[model samples]
Target: MKGIKIGEYLVNSCTMYIEPVEYANKIYSHIVEVEEEFLSPFKPLQNIKNSCDYFGVDYESRRKGT
Candidate 1:
């Protein structure tokens, strides 16, 4: 899957999953913001991990892309 790599974390691209669409959207946006240096990475990474774990999805897939 396509994703953005921030340091060691991998935030996957927005995909149609069984989970709520908002979760995926948030993950994408949070990572993008981090990449763009608009926000610090800690909170967003925490939220992304929580969302992925809650939905039983793999958010940590390594790929470099927009």
Candidate 2:
């Protein structure tokens, strides 16, 4: 498994999910673009609406509200 260095920890590309967490005393979340291989093996945002059955990942939106 390929991984990247983040400060002092090496984050692996094999990620199941990503969520917002406190960083530097701030409550926010963001994704970083790895210039080498790829950001991650799985992209939820793109995959969520990427394809109906592509890559064996079926993402369906059931509700919409704000």
**Highest TM-score, which number?**
1
Q: What does the lDDT read for residue 25 in candidate 2?
A: 61
Local accuracy by lDDT, each model = 0.40, 0.36
C-alpha lDDT of candidate 1 relative to the true structure: 0.40
Residues 20-60 of candidate 1: C-alpha lDDT, one tens digit per residue = 11333343332443234222234554655666676677666
| Regions of model 2 farther than 4 Å from truth | 1-13, 28-66
Q: Give lDDT for model 2.
A: 0.36
**Tens digit of per-residue lDDT, candidate 2, span 1-66:** 233423211233543433344445643323343444222233334433433344453344322421
Q: Which pairs of residues clash in candidate 1, taking residues 3 or more apart in a chain or in different chains?
A: none
lDDT score, candidate 1, position 12? 47
TM-scores, all candidates, are 0.29, 0.22
* RMSD of each predicted structure: 13.2, 10.3
**Clash tally for model 1:** 0
